[model samples]
Target: MHKFIVHGGRPLSGTIKPKGSKNEALQVMCATLLTEAIVTINNIPDITDVHSVMQLLTLLGVQIVPLGKGSYQFCAAHLHTDVTLTEIFRQEYAKVRGSIMLLAPLLVRFKSVSVPKPGGDRIGRRGVHAHFEGLERLGVTFCYNVDEEAWKAKCTTLSGSYILMPEPSVTGTANIVMAASMAKGKTIIYPAACEPHVQQLCHMLVAMGATITGIGSNILTIEGVAHLSGTVHTILPDMLEIGSFIGLAAATKSTLTITDVPINLFTPVWSCFRKLGIRLEEDDNSLHIPFQPSYHIQKEIDGNLLSLSDAVWPGIPADLISIAIITAVHAHGHILIHQKMFESRLFFVDHLIEMGARLILCDPHRVHVVGLGNAYRLRGTRMSSNDIRAGITLLIAALAAEGTSTIANIHQIDRGYEQIDQRLNALGASIERA
Candidate 1:
């Protein structure tokens, strides 16, 4: 257990690079299990959740070698197909929700596998029905064991079929595509998540000899291949991290240059921030957030309160809603933040209110924020980090507050962001992890 002692009132200014996409890295790492050849992955984020997934893969007998910074070589040539729900596997795999994705590749290669119920940030109820439903469409059968308290899936061979997902689930879509890569016949998935990470996974599978179409759309068609050959893939920059940084820069009135950002993927994020009257400059390979006194939250054309909410892909990312809420406190006008996906995500607004920012939690899914603007400064205080997104948001708010603040449960932040305390400290912020 670690806590961050952050001395507020210091503005962060420097060039900092975003780490590899954590969401993309997890799916890409699991893709290694679909092949016998060596799979080399670049720009892998060194975060806790990703490391947990790597440990899970190692337990499944996949050989993984660390080839220096942000690079890994994985080979499932001598993979062990059998997975018993041992205490060790349960303890490790339950720390990362991405561990559930292992079932897809394992079932495709070995026909049967056991997996514990996935565990991760308790932001909301994240059901796995979409994953099981998609798998069943591919000729897979799964059952839960009462005594073992684990899921058991069995299949002799998967014959692809059309799967219309109940929702556009990101991880669920990735799981189905991975399992369908080697299944017989063709698999068509409708209403699939078109998130950037999901698209990245599809591209990687295509490179490994799988035939896939509809790269960036809700409809995906995959023609099963006999087998896949390993290929090298590079992860894009972490967009969530980039959004957090942008919020931090705006909240603290700091000038920051974020290098190597994937600007091509910023249309949705940029549009959302623009609604808050926040502007950023983009270069060929970097994003520049200049120091400004404050931004005025823009109202609707009819002068109604601006509402920012999250939806499926191309929507304001659910992960960034927390940061946006914190950023809203420092802006000039009021904004309504609706976190529709996670019911409990708005509960963290109480801590922001504790810091002297005016916020009303309308419900579990909606929050009404009244910006204090530059005329009033938030008074910092002790707070507990409830989840990954909220932890970083609290950290950003603390940096923009008036006094020192203590943030406990920083491990939540570490699960996604790599060396965040050290990296933020490098940007002239006084954050000590203890």
Candidate 2:
């Protein structure tokens, strides 16, 4: 167990670049199993989830060579193992949801994949039915043994068709895309998740000789290919991290210049932030978050209070809803945060309430936060992290609070943010990880 001991009431001032996207790197790595050629991925995030994916790949007989820090060359060309070492990696994989992606590639190439129940944030019921349902559209059969707590899916040749996902689940969409890329004929996916990470995986597949249209749209067209060769691709910057930093700067009144932000990748995200009174500046390859006025929630067109809710890609991300909630606490007016994607994600607000936040928990999926408007600073207090995003949001609140605060169970934070304590320390934040 690790903890972050933070001396609060300090405004972090300096520039910091976010690490690569963890979500993107996981999908890219899983996509490698679809091909026999060497795939080189750059800008990989040095996070626990990624390392677990790498471990899973190695267990499947793929050779992963380190090109440098945050870079790797993966070759599954000679992979011979059919048995997924799920038992060895089960505990680790249980820490991140992206581990479920292994099923598609394994089922495609080897005909069978056995995996333990995938684990991630305990936010809500994340069903694998989307993945199974989508893959079944391509001729895959699934069997689950409840007593063993494992699932096995097998398929011969996948026949492509139209797949309408129950929800725009990001990992589910990636699994389907990977499976469809190698199936016979063409496959169409409707109501797909078009997040930047999903887009990057689609582009990487295309670079490896897979045909995929509708790069940034809800409808995706993937034409099956006989074979795919390895190619070099760079993972996109972590937009979630970028958004978190934006919130951090606003909460602490700091100016931060983030480089290589992939500005176009974040138009919708920035627009959502603007609705909350957080303004951002963009350049060709960078984004600047300057000190702004005290934040406030915008009113609705009908002159009623509006709530900030998360949806699929193009809409606000559900993962950032917690950070948005914390940002709203420091803003001027009250706003509702509807975490439609998850049930328990809003439970972390109780910690904020302890720090003197004016919040009303409407339900498991919604909360209303009324900002203190710079009139009151959150008082420091001991807390525990319940999930990744909430953990980071608590850290942010701790940094903005008065006096000292201790956060336990920091491994939850390490699973997502790489060297978060060190990175924040570099930005003049008084935090120690022990």
Candidate 3:
């Protein structure tokens, strides 16, 4: 029940390092189920979702030891349970979308798995039919009564085949890859998501003895292996966090150096920020954000100002659309933001509007932000978080606004960002956790 009370209008000027990617950590942790050897993972984010996944792994009899801060050694060699404690694991697993990633590894090891409907942002109808269909092509059988809320899946052995995903759902593709890793034959996945997180998961699996080709493309070829031996791997920096930091620095006129950014992983994101008139400098593996003279929105091809729109992977990510909306408010031009992935993501714009932002909510998925420019300062106001991205976006707005702002339901923010208040405080942000 903690909240963040932030005094706004402060320029954050310092060095900040982002934690491990939450998306990669969750899937990589679940991928441990495929191996019996010790796997060492570094740069793990200390977030609630990661804790929940660890709890689920512990319940399944996997041995996990915290070697040091942000480092963990996991060995699933002694995994002794085929049936998860349903009552205990259900609620925790449903709290985040990454929970669905457990299905693939579970199916490979135990040949049976039952997971409750995963919970995530209420953006739209995120169907698991793709996962089931992909698994079904590999000889998995699903049996459950939807009305009774009981679901189970079992497969004697999986034989790989071609799986053409209807959409490039990131988690769904990861699930299929995990399932295919230990199958009896080769599996080809088409139109798969090539997001950096997904590529990281695939590379980790390959490092752990899985044979996966196609590291950064839509089509993936996975060769089945009988067993996997664990290996030491380092998780990549959080790109979503990097994007959030970029928005925060620009909104607050801060100069920040984000270390270990994995610049190659965020090429599309970097391009998107450039279009917003935010300057960035990339070193070997870090990104430097200098204090900008002004943030301005680029014009459209039709000679009219256009909004930033979110699409699938390789385009702007849907998770950062909210952050972009807040960034638009501090820019020097008019821009529209269209959230095509989730219908409800744009609903949080009202909270920013209360802070004196000139924004028009065109619909559930569209917003028009007319920048207040440097002439006006947004006034801080109290806000409650509705989702992970929105929560951080509100915090960014609060940091850039005048006066003090209190953000409640910070647990939503904690689910993704690791020690966010502490990290921002280190960067000269006057934020305190209450």
Candidate 4:
């Protein structure tokens, strides 16, 4: 029932720091189950999804003590294996997508797990077949328990084997990496997701005494070890959050600096934004997005319309497509937006089209946008946030719109972005959480 009351057309100023990567934090949180020692993680985002993962850990008897803001200590020393025996655990486990990550780690430690089908964003059908298929190669067997709506998984033992990933899925890659870390033999994985978050997970696992090679590349060679000890790990700053801020500053024509950004992890993002002619300055660890009255979309070398598509790690992230669509509203030119990852992701463009953006819906996966430049400002309207990415996109559109706007079901936004309204309001933007 929560909603965000936003006043449009407010110029924003000041520096904003992005939170830790939600994807990395979630993956690393699940990785903690790999060892029995105390594992301390820093720079964890205080968002709903992170909190949900923490709850799942606690239900499994992991001792959680808050060290400081965005820092916590986790010890699985007293962890119990019969977690699904509790009704509360099953109920809570079924509510978060992150619960799927628990399977690989628990299977490595206890060799048996009863995990319910996970719930998460309804953007599209995100199946766990890859995760299980890869784990099954490690000597795991799965049975679906229709009565409990859960999957009963048991592993006699783990044996590392060559796993050519069906696709470069982030969670699937992470799950396989974790299971292979403790397997008995050598595991070779190719076409693995090499996204920054996935790399961070591999790096963290390595620090915990696992032998992993090719940390940044898609192909990873893992030598299974007998034991893994706990270690302290810090997550990278949220790249999705950084991209959202860039889109917001561009749409609002504001000069804002996002501090302490990992510019090295954002090659594709920078390329796409530059293609829109949005000027950005980079320091060693920070990024400066200057205020520009207008910008243009740069076409191809042969003067064709610019095309932005989401692909594997080296390509533009699909998560930013919605925000890019909003940024394109203020830039002058035509571009094709292809959201090939999820069939239903581009459907949220209807709300922006209603707000006066000159966009054509080519299909469920593509949108042709004719950037109106600064000639038109989107008029405020009431809308519902259907997913995390769509919610942030609406917030950006509302902030740069002409009047007052209402965004309902803001819980979707809270699942990923931490204190987004308060943070933006701190920079002189008006956002009321009602």
Candidate 5:
């Protein structure tokens, strides 16, 4: 029910650090269920989705202690053996797709676990076939219970084998990898997701005595271990959050510096934004975007329009597509924003068009943004956020608009970004939480 009243037409200048990866935190937190010893994780993001994952773990009998800000200790010494998940979990699972990750770790431990259909942003169809397929290869069987609308899964004798992921899905990769960690033989995952967060999970598992190789590439090999011990792991800075801040600086015409950046993971992002003539300076551990009144979209040397699309990795992340579109609204020249991964992701552009940006919604998956540079300004109005990325993208558009704007249903945003209004407010952006 929370809302953000954003006052527009102001530059946000200051330095901020991106929080720990929300996606990484969810995966690693679930990975904690794979061990009985104490596992301490640093840089846990204080966001709703993470809190939901933590709550799910606690409900499943994981002992969690707050070490301090952005840190926690977990010990899954015992878990409930009942077929039924906690009522609160069933009720809340729809809001947290991360809950689906509990399937593998729980299946490996309890031999059986039941969970309702997972939910998250309504971006598009996110199928669990990949999860069931990869785990099923390792001796897991799943049955759908019609009355409960849940999947009942059991793994009697876990054994590792080669798995070619149906897709490079981050969650699916983590789930199968965790299950494979306890499998009885060598497991080879070809075309695994090699995002920094996925690498973080594999590295964490290795540190905990799981044998893993190919840490940062599409192919990964794991030797099944007897058991995994607890280990301390620090999550990489959230690349999505880092990209959002960069887009904010470009939209608001501010010289902003983002510290604690995992710059190596953002090569494609740098190239994508630099195509818009936005200056992004990188160091060993931070990113800086200098103020620029206007930037032009670099077309193909042969005079073709620039196309920005989402790919698996070393490509512009799909999560950043929303912010990139809004940033493109304020730039010069025209570019095609393609959301090939999710049909619903680009639907939020209607609000930008309502705010006076020139854009063509070619279809559910494609948009053409005619960047007017400084010659144009969006006029803000009331809008409701439908998802995390779209919510933050709307906030950024409002900040660069000509008048105040109200964003409703900001809880979707709260689920992802931690204290975003407060953080952007610190950078001189006028965002009031109500």
Candidate 6:
């Protein structure tokens, strides 16, 4: 029940490095269950969701040792086989959707595993059908218990085959790949998610002696191995955090230099933000955004209103849409923010409209923001964060407002960003966590 009290009207300028990807950490940590030897992971983000998944792994008998900051060693030499659907596990599983990933690795090792329905942000209907479908294609059988709301899957021997994912689901792909790693034959996965984090997970599996081809493409071919040994893997930097910082710098007139960023993975992001007139300079490993007088949204050639939307990989990530909308509020022109992936995500704009932002909520999935372009300033007020992305977006908006603001339920933001208040405060932004 913590809150963040922010003092507004200050520009943040400093160098900061994005933490390891939370999504990647979740997937890679689950992969540890696929091996009996020691696996060391580096650059893990110290965030709530990641910690929760680690806790779940520990409960399932994975030995974890802290190697230092952002590093840990895991050994699943002994597993607590009977605790999968225990009451304690069910409670922890409700905290993160990534908990479902443990099922594949556990099944690969134990031949049977049971799990409760997974839970995550109420962004949209995230169906687990893709997970069951892909795994079922590889010779796994599952049965659901309506009374207990649990699913039990068992397969004495997994024989890999071709699996075309119904969608490019990141977690689903990770789950099936982990299972396929221990299967008996060649597995081909088409329409696989090729995000950097997904690629990182695939690379980690390959390091552990799994044969995988098409590391960064929609199609992946995996040859099952008899056994996998432990290997060390480092996660990629969090691209969502980098996108948030870029939007924050643009809206607040700050100069932010983000070091250790993989600038090439953000090709689509740079193009989208450039359309909003927020120029960025990048080097081999870092990116710099200098201070600007005013931001302006670029228009189309035929004079149509510009729009920023989310797509699969290589598009503006859906998680960054909220930040883009907040940046658009301070830019000069008008732009339509279309959140086609999730309906509940764009509903958070009501809080921004309450703070004197000129926005039209066309529907649950679309918003039109009219920038004041420094002609007017938002008056800070109280707001509650609905989700992780929306929470950080509101924090950025409060930092650019004229007065002080209070953001309650900051735990949502804490789930993704590691020590966000402390990190932004290092850049001269005044944020007090209570």
* Model 5 alpha-carbon drift over 4 Å, by segment: none
From the highest lDDT down, the ranking of the candidates is 6, 4, 1, 5, 3, 2
* RMSD vs true structure, all candidates: 0.9, 1.3, 1.4, 1.0, 1.0, 1.1
Error of 2 at 331 (Å): 0.8
Relative to the true structure, candidate 4 reaches a TM of 0.98
Candidate 3 lDDT at 330 equals: 91
lDDT of 2 by residue, 93-124 (tens): 66578889988988877887678888778888
Model 6: per-residue lDDT, tens digit, 1-434?
89999999999999999999989999999999999999999999999999899999999999999999999999999999888868999999989888989889988888998889887787877789889999999999999999989998999899999998999888899998899988999999989988888899899999999999998998999999999999999998999999999999998999999999887777887887889989899988999999998978999899999988998887778888998999999999999989997878888888899999999999999999999888988889999987899999999999999999999999999999999999999999999998
Candidate 4 residue-wise lDDT, 148-206, digit = tens: 88899999999999997888888899999999999999998888999999999999999
Predictions in order: lDDT: 0.90, 0.87, 0.88, 0.91, 0.89, 0.91
- Models 1 onward score TM values of 0.98, 0.97, 0.97, 0.98, 0.98, 0.98
Cα lDDT tens digits, model 3, 1-434, are 99999999989898888889999999899988888899999999999989989988888888999999899999888765554646777778778888888888888878777778887766666889888899899998988768646468889999989998988889889999998988988999999999988999999989888999997899999999988898998998999999999999999998999998778778888888887889999999889999986878888878787768877778999888888888888988888888887777778888898999998999898898889679788999999987899999999999999999999999999999988998898888899899
Model 4 Cα shift for residue 328 (angstroms): 0.9
Q: Which stretches of candidate 6 lie over 4 Å from their true place?
A: none
Residue 332 shift from truth in candidate 2, angstroms: 0.6
Q: How many backbone clashes does candidate 2 have?
A: 0
lDDT of 3 at 295: 75
Q: In model 2, which runs have C-alpha deviations exceeding 4 angstroms?
A: 80-82
Candidate 1 lands at a TM-score of: 0.98
The model with the greater TM-score, 2 or 6, is 6
Return the lDDT, model 3, position 231.
92
